[model samples]
Target: MASVGFRGDLSQAFRARIPILYVESYEEHRALAEIAAVARDPELVRTPRALLTWSPTSGLIQPDGTARRGAIDPEDALVAALRTEEPSVFVFCDLHGTLGPAVVRLLRDVAVAFRAGPVPRTLIILAPALHIPHDLEKEVSILDFPLPAETEIRALLDRMIDDNVATGRITVTLTPGDRERFAKAALGLTLHEAENAFARAMVDDAVLAPADLAVVHEEKRQAVRKSGLLEFVEPHTGLADVGGLENLKRWLLRRDGTWLDEAAAWGLPAPRGVLITGVPGCGKSLTAKAVAAGWGLPLLRLDMGRVFSGLVGSSEQNMRTAIRAAEATSPCVLWVDEIEKGLAASGSGSGSGDNTGTGARVFGTFLTWLQEKTRPVFVMATANDIARLPAELLRKGRFDEIFFVDLPTGPERTAIWTVHLNRRLSRPAVAGRLDLTPALLTELTKLTDGFSGAEIEQAVVSALYDAFAQRRPLEREDLVRAVTNTVPLSVTQAERITAIRSWAADRAVAATAPEDWDMGTGNGRAVEF
Candidate 1:
């Protein structure tokens, strides 16, 4: 379904006698252009209205774009709007910050007058955020001026390219797919912001290659930065960086291109998401990050703490904003780390409990969206306590699969050790001296008997520190000492780990291979290293 464009939406709202429209936006010029478009189109408005703009800096402006005499104050502008004989649309720009009783009264008065009057005049209040007064809440209309669509962003990019190429200052080598990709990259940016980003890329070494797409991602991160609830993470590691979990990795790889046009043509719905729950440090969160990187999508972390606002009703709004942002940047991954922690409060979300189930309502909103969202926004949620997650979250159709991440088995541990040691030892200064043979990896793996992947990595780090203190290269003895000195979580929380494993054996799919599931078959209790 096509979304309501500015011209269509504004026209519909205006024609429907929506007295006062409060638009939250940063693109003032684009909004003005939309208003002008609405005014000029005979079919858009029943009786074409004259477009007039009002800003505190410039006061009230006439239909011809000329300033009115001494109409600087917003009060004067509202009075003039009420008195005007011609049907007009008074576009009030950025007046929300200064909205007070006096301004609100004038607005209410104008709204009543416009509703009664035969002329078609509208008082639109423009601001970056929504802050409606209780008095005017029922009367005033609120709308969001959405970011420019990909088509608009693409047009802006093409114009920028044409402008630069005409001067012979920048080189342009964009294929049709390249242009589509670039337009898609600038998806969430405003028209002006997209232009600025494109200009920055074109001027950078005077080239606009596929390599320059990173510049767009870098610039678009500003949106996530402003949203205190969602954080943009750079996922440098791919599936290859993950030591094991071949089952999980293979599942993800199969869904990697399923969201593409070809897969859609094959009548495949985009892969919804997966829940990775298990041991605390068994690469649950790492898999979330790696999936986004491997799929060539941006990763946005939803900070649940921020989503639960102290202000009533704001939590719902915040959730909606986050959802809008994620959809706007479609075909992206939305990662919620330790998701169970956020939704557990959702039991409180139903509104019947204390706090009126505000938290529960928020989770309800998220859950409903997860089940129904049409956008290709794959949710990669990680949780340690699957038991704490809402029962509905694990039901069929909520997620593609629920995979349980367990402690590394013998070979998985060996692979994990090899990955860590090689990554550290393959460095320029240590590559020559370090021996990353299969025998050494097997010995190191046995040393980490009950260790999680994180424990193994930490052991490697401790070994490096020991060698650093000795002012010598890392030796097998240092690693062995580190392993002996450290204790793994499996022993300390053995009962809890066993309980989690038992719970997952039937409920969740194993992230490990069939062979990896057979732990302690060939492995001994002693630290072999």
Candidate 2:
């Protein structure tokens, strides 16, 4: 009950004699401390209750190290709690790992006894995960184990610093702001994890500074490791690496750092997120990565394909686990690439045979999270086909905005060519050797009017390959031949492109300016390449 900051509910449970309470947490010692505090509270409970705890190894042991005669098995542990007459809180640690039919029966017995007895005796189950046999599901209440709050984490850091200062061994030179930064970075971590992160940071520099926030983030990675659902991406590319889409870039930049305290003081809620849909290779995925780097936050790519499971109820559980992982790492960017394909399974409601309605359920679970999530997890969902996406998903309040990324325009192509060419020529082997000037980029951009940001990049690579194969310096002619030989998506999928253009005309905000959007099309419109 305490780990998730639910200590206040403990009293009501005690008063109502709720049969059993379960708290899922990784920090056994910290959870024990919270329960101990709850046992002493007079406001929540009418009378102060004694605290006793049991584990498989520890059996039935009092807080003061006194061992009550009991069996080592879990069934006996519950009997021990029931037989004890004193008004007390009995915590069963790691008992879920050994839950059986017999254990469930014993727990049911303890609940019946607690509900009927005058002396309030509560059985609190503490485990890293939740497991309730169906018989006791109604009788048992599960409480979320919340991560360490900012104030709690900062106190832990201060205590660590004071200990080091008293020892006169490690340096203690953190400003109040520095301490707060470390604590904020350590958010979503358990108290034990926070202490270890602080200790590791101190050992690295002998003093705690704002620079040591990386150590705290490293600790947060452990949570990601445990959750195979969300992949933690190390963002190295920034918006500078992305070309064109100035309107989209500006929208994102204006909201940078909006999740901080200052933004809250301004009475603005964090921007929800954006849905980027249109051309497949028009920098949709690239912008997702750039935003995380530009905003200075961790990037998490959620693999939607991995969320579904064959086992009944497991698929829903996986979705919940993924959401928890994302929320736990708040102030982070969540990239769901090709989101349309991931959710396309929702429409398969056949009157015939569609199995268990699993697809619809999984999609519903994701939609609910997207609509109701209050965390700072900014979801960046990219899509290529608008029709594949559920119609309800495009409605108001799902995403802050839906952006349509078309094929690069003439000027945008010029910018894309410039970025790619400059990047290639600046390499150690070619820097200052290739005369890649604005004139050459302008010539290349004019020739590739229908190309995308990705196709433009490929054009650069093709030009380099042609030049390298000849064992000579690159000339503008090499790029000209490359563009002439390439067929852009706009040419191969003209009808589809026209359909997308018409669909997004009124429904989505064009990722490019009007002048730019009108400059490119391989259909009835002219294309030099």
Candidate 3:
């Protein structure tokens, strides 16, 4: 609200001097309507009459009812409207692209003439897009109209439902919870989108259940498609599906209720975020998705690569826009997968031709937002290597916790193996006949030692593929062959993996148990927080 007021002031300040000006949106129309309705001052009565700007092609016409062309001039209309004794507002609708130097000059003269008189008038330019010419940069004032709020959407839905019922249409049956979901899903959607989605929901289901949420999600998908950079990912894995990382799982559980419960009332600050830095394919990305599902919050994946652009200043603007969008739709999880690659590329001087200057600037801006942002956007950032991560990001307070996910432990391995095998057999738990006993779980875990969670899942998938081809159930030999044929991360990148575990031993929070979690020992040793 404060931001809206500040932006509104920009237009109001210009309006104080200029009777001919441009503003945006229906909000201005409603505001001016209220003002025009009640104000009775004679000086106010001298204000210009508001008019909507439209091209001659938009069926816009002159008062004389002739074809209005080549450019539908608002100058004569604005000047004549201001001649009245009644205070008025002249609106130029959708004239953003048509605004020119001649029109600007004419508006400027009208503003000067009105300022010299005792009477006041206002000319409003309404556009969804902002266009400021170089010459009118200082003169033009822009205001960003916010999308409809949750309350507004709810009211609109209620009214629409009521009207439909009154018209002998099917009655809308929406519970309070369903109503809340409808409002939440409509957050990023425009008013039209929300209306259409709600209408479609009624047409398809005749009732609004929280399950009818795909319509809302579709609206969000449409918005994301417009951005071009963001891709809405459908998460396939869950916490149980993720191998090992017991410590990380427990930590996430502690935060599950933090966003939705009594934590704030108890004076606990909102959980800031988590930083997962570890070896590749160790469930870093999987954990991010799992956390969102665990917490029952929307997941917004930030594509850092899309922030930089060929145009100057656009990168920073794009970053700000992305941040604002994420913040606006709060109580959500923000996943920045392999963030190190994107940030390092921007900051490594390779982008700026060995000049670290631009990279530093971008990094600084990001750091400030990370620290100062008050939004409840749980940033789940993953990095394969910390060598490139800036020290500033590692400082306390940026992330609520930093967890290092090393190779799976024996017990962690057993859990991972059970999860993968169970998933493969379509029996998540030990059920009738598909005998995956504790002994089989242990043997599989030990045999596939040093494998990441991803590798473990892949092994099970490969065995299942083999079974499918042969028209038989997977046997122990299939599992053994899969393990033997595959070289784990331990053997493939032994030196790098060892160094990472060593760095994480003292410097980071372990995602495994104590006593046996130390990766520096060449064997997975646990180290407690």
- Scored by lDDT, the top model is 1
Estimate the TM-score of every prediction.
0.90, 0.88, 0.79
By TM-score, the better pick of 1 and 2 is: 1
Give one digit per residue, the lDDT tens place, for model 1 in 1-529. Answer: 0124667888898888787998888888877777788877898888888888888899998877799997889888888888987788888888887788898899889889988888788888877778888999888887767787767777778888888899999998898777877887778777777788788899899988878887888776787777676888999999877867777898999997676666878999999999988888989999999998898778999988778777789988889889988887766899999998878757545532346778878888998999999888899999887668778888888899998887777766877787788888876654445677878878887888779889998999998988788677788888889999887898988888887888888888878667545454432112111
lDDT of 2: 0.79
TM-score, ranked from best to worst = 1, 2, 3
Worst 10 residues of 3 by lDDT: 38-47
Better of 2 and 3 by lDDT: 2
Model 2 regions lying over 4 Å from their true place = 1-5, 158-181, 206-211, 347-355, 427-434, 463-478, 514-529
- The candidate, 1 or 2, that scores higher on lDDT is 1
For 136-186, candidate 3 gives per-residue lDDT tens digits of 665555555566667777887888778877887655667776676577667
